[model samples]
Target: MTARTLHVDPSNAEQARSWDGEEGSYWAAHADDFDRALRAYQRPFLDAAALHRGERVLDIGCGSGLTSRAAARLTVGGPVLGVDLSGPMLRVARREAEREGLDSVRYEQVDAQTYPFPEASFDIAVSRMGVMFFADPVTAFRNIARALRPGGRVALLVWQGLERNEWFRSFATALAAGRDLPVPPPDEPGPFAMSDPGVVRDTLTAAGFDTPELTGLERPMTFGRDAERAYSFVSGMLAWMADDLDETGRARALANLRVDIEAHATPEGVRYASAVWVVTATRP
Candidate 1:
């Protein structure tokens, strides 16, 4: 087999490895489940983009290509390109796109922070629960800006904050019943990295985007089909979190999490209140 070369940014090296390794595999394996959980964010994110017919689109961190497929359906006159850092996730994205017979949608396994797209090639860029993991947000956004035509727009959905998202906080607290899990720094390269609107606006402005519009949205996110299923899915997905614990400790954590999930169960599913920011910007 021929050797492959990657041109990922040094700042994103660790994330590229993690997303291209076990984490990516796990996400691909449970693609449908996670899709269901985050499905509520899709409509709002897309509405904010207001994609036009014939607009060339780019999807950043397009895990499993769900949003890419959606964009493809909207833009019949032009193709949609979805780029991500995870090989396994891209594999799943390709499979799903083929299964759905989405001819205009394409998937590329690349570090979007530095991918050299033809200048002014795209008319719009959209991300659903993506674009928040960049180690250098400004550099990444700037690189993306270079790919857009003049007046091109960007729409993204980002988690509002740790305290506002019960899905993560409840599960985290449950898992840490015995162990003290340190809170990650607010500026860490994680989901809530862009929670602060001021930082997001400043970063986009520095990256050549015009003043951004932010809208706070709250929605119900599904965890699973039922409480039992939710517990099984969540525990398995986060099993690694307790891998460092003793056997008894791991068992206890799982048991406590199970009870907590059960209490929040409804006929629809184990639902949680999630808050996010629907941010939109335009290149000058």
Candidate 2:
């Protein structure tokens, strides 16, 4: 493992560990699959960014560098720095960038919550389904604000409430297999942390950003081309759900998951409805 350039915030230590360990490894190994799942949102999210030529970009929690690479192309020779806590994902990101000949794109393994970024160094900061895992969102956004030049913009695509997301609801329901699973509080550091528009607005405001514009976006996230493939992908990603189950219980959960996934399969692909908030704010 490469040494991190800066200390991770104590609140983000567990997140750092997970994203740098098994979870990160899974994401890295299935980089293409994960990217394909979220590909539907890329265009709209990038469109909202409105990247200009020669504009430097900072991509927070940039897993596998897909968004960074896309931003690099839009920047037209500008530098794009992608920072994340996952060493495995960063390696994949670097390899993908090199493969694409995006010399202006770079990846670094660092926790965005507390990384000592050069102040006012970037023209734009963006995150796609990222920024939600920050344990101390206000502090993290403040740090991000300090990294941006005056009038610099920040664009983020974050999940909406868990109930509105069919992908998560269906999966969790299937995997629970009659067991009651508690949902994390909406304000906690997780995918749904920023699901509330009110919290997002207040967080950015407290972090020295202009009032943010929150736009709701709905889309279908592709899991795979068929039920079998989708089951393999999703089960692998979410296998931890069955960790506490006995062998028979685990089998039952897996069966339930397969059935649920198969129900959603279509000729085009196995896709599930998803909702997100596309938020854009500027550092004053």
Candidate 3:
């Protein structure tokens, strides 16, 4: 295999590795499943973006190009470029776009935090559960601000906190049963780094974006069609957390996770309460 070209921040080296390695590959393989799981947030995210015809769009961290394709449908006269750190996910995105005949959608493997996007190249920038992984969020948003035309808008969906999101809270506790999971440092690059509204506001303001309008919303995150399916899916997604465990420990974690999942099972499907911050801001 030829080595891939990387246009990422040195600080994001660890993330690039995880996303480009096993994590990215797993997501690529389960692209459709993951999309279905996150389907609830799509409409809310797009509604906030308010995309229009002929409007250029930038989809930051556009994994598997699902959101990118949705944006492309609105802006047929303009292009939708989805940039991500994972080459595997980008490939899956490209394949799906071609299969769907979405000619206006494209995916690029680039770090949105530091990518040299052309000035005033986009009318809107959006991310669905994508903007929170930045090692240097201020620089990332600053770069994004520079990419947009004056008055261009940005809308994103980020998780609120561990306590608020039942999906992570339940699974994490179950997965760490009988084991000690160290707490991550505050402001560390992870899913919940942007959870605090005050930090988000400060970061955006410093990044040259107007004060962001943050709306908190709660919705169900679909796990699977049933408890059995949900257990398998959830286990696979969180399997990395048990990498350090022995075989017995891994099995115990899965056992605990199954019980936790069973409690949330519904006739419609396995649903978990998820909380998010739907933030919108304008480039000024």
C-alpha TM-scores of all predictions: 0.96, 0.98, 0.96
What is the TM-score of candidate 3? Answer: 0.96
lDDT-better candidate, 2 vs 3: 2
lDDT of 1 by residue, 22-112 (tens): 8888888989999999888888788889988989999999999999989988876479999988888888999988998888888887888
What are the per-residue Cα lDDT tens digits for candidate 2 across 183-206? 868988889999999999999999
- CA deviation > 4 Å runs, candidate 2: 2-6
| lDDT (CA) per prediction | 0.88, 0.93, 0.88
Task: List ranges where model 1 is wrong by over 4 Å.
Answer: 1-5
Question: Model 3, residue 235: what's the lDDT?
Answer: 93
Ranking by TM-score: 2, 1, 3
Clashing pairs in 1: none
Model 3 lDDT tens row, 1-284: 11145757898878888888888888898887788888888898889999999899999999999889989887764799999888899999999899999988888888889999999999999998888888999999999999999999899998898888888878888989677786544498888888999999999999999999999998898888899988988898889778898999989998999998898889888999989999999998
Scored against the true structure, residue 207 in model 1 reaches a CA lDDT of 99
* lDDT (Cα) of model 1: 0.88
Steric overlap count per candidate: 0, 0, 0
- lDDT, residue 54, candidate 3: 87
